[model samples]
Target: MELHNVDLNLLVVFDHLLRLRTVSGAAKALGLSQPAVSNALARLRRIFDDDLFVRSAKGMLPTPLAQELAEPVSYALEALQNALNRKVSFDPRHSDRDFRLAMTDIGEIHFIPRLMGTLRELAPGVSVATVRNTAVNLAEEMSQGKVDLAVGHLPELTSEFFQRRLFRQRYVCMFRPGHALDKRTIRLRDFLEADHVVVTAAGTGHARADEILARQGVQRRIRLRVPHFAALADIVASTDLIATVTHKFAERSAKYFGLRYVKHPVDLPEIQINLFWHSRYHRDPANQWLRTQVFDLFSE
Candidate 1:
């Protein structure tokens, strides 16, 4: 209970436990073993005079006291980490630091190669790690400095985080070569009649394109639903289901999958792909350098 006796590192373990809600999961996230996480949990319980988290059928359930402690602990840790980061000057060329990013598979497809190419030329000592586990709360991830940059359209990321609209992408419907609808522009009538495959990249069944379609009172028959865009091309190529995807990805499918892409008939709103970072690192020189690299690469 004494502030002087508490190890600041224990707070990090407590924070991860709250976020993941499981000792094993927190251990994996923090790169620690299960025994280590269990020991940390025991220490946290002794410090708080509470069970902190209880094992349940679902997962580790946080006690009321633990719930109360989560926010303030996260904030204090982030602030301290931010102050410490600012004290050291970042030299990209010589600093062997790990730069982490949270991005979707689509963002990996679009950005990683060229970005890494540039990094090799400019900052060879910098290593990159991509985090694809969408289950983690992104706002918490960024605020805690676990993630440096997040790529994609996440409307949920607002207020505390700083966001930059990297680019906007238009929708295109794709089908295999020699399909009945492959030759020309698809009309709204054809679009509605087609059996469609929807890509729910965020695991939210509804997409921005679908919202636009609903506004227009047009409901296409959804035949298949996939979790990622990368899985769509093969499914579309092999099956009769047509998928509406971004033009950039559709172009790749056309060339690699032997599929054909056409403009979607209904006026679908362009999807905004953004880059997000925590405001805590807004003035950090290394973060600023990384931000500049992203903008300069895709600013067009």
Candidate 2:
């Protein structure tokens, strides 16, 4: 409990271990030996009088006490790091920082190509990795530094996160180019009567289209229900199924899939897609750089 008596280096090991959930991973990330990380963890357990993490087949699972300490410990470390490195310049062209992001499949398809193009031209040494937004605890992952940024309309990432609006997106009805409903003007009756490919992109704002329609007593003759947008273009391109998707996604994939999209006949609220990051990283130089690039490149 005495601050002066505790070693600061152990906290670094603890942070890495919590983020990676494995001693070997933590050691590799910290440039230390596995034994050193294990020894640091042992010391941490003795100091806290609790087994902070328990080894299991699933990796080092955090105990309740560790979970309780996660945020404050992470926040303190981030603050300390920012304070210590406030004046250190970040040379993106020379620095090799790996940024992890959380994104949906559509976001990866829509954003990665252009993002990589920009990165290759400016920050060639920097690497980027993406995980599904719904795959992990996004808030906890960002808080612990597992994911650096999450791009999408993720409503659950509020409270502890900071976000900047990127653009307002609306839904569009997409289908094969020569489909019967390909006319410039689409009627609601034709839309509702046609076979639809419903995309259940759960855990994202995109899924609300169906809910909104249902609330208005509008029903589509759904011929298929898919969980992701990755294959929607292919399915809709070959079938008579019309899909309701975000305008950007529909526009981006139309050329490749030989598809056409029209304005949704039924009215629906537009969704705001945003760039999100943990508030603790607000002052971190590298985090600031990455967020600035995303805002500059993607915002309308």
At residue 209, what lDDT does model 2 achieve?
Answer: 70
lDDT of 2 by residue, 1-300 (tens): 788988999988888989999999999999999999999999999999999999899999999999998998899999999999878567899989999989998999988999999999999999999999998988999999889999998888779999999999999889898899998979999998899988888878887777898999998898899888888888888889998889998888777877899999998999999999999888888999999999999999
Tell me the tens digit of each residue's lDDT in model 1 across 203-277.
321266776677888888998887877787889999889987888788878788989988888777788777888
> Would you list the clashing residue pairs of candidate 1?
none
* Top-lDDT candidate index: 2
**Candidate 1, superposed: residue stretches over 4 Å from native:** 1-87, 203-206
TM-score of each: 0.66, 0.71
Give the TM-score comparing model 2 with the true structure, all chains together. 0.71
Q: Model 2, which residues run further than 4 Å from truth?
A: 1-86
| CA lDDT of every candidate | 0.84, 0.90
Q: Give residue 231's error in model 1 in angstroms.
A: 2.1
Q: Per-candidate RMSD vs. true structure?
A: 18.2, 16.2
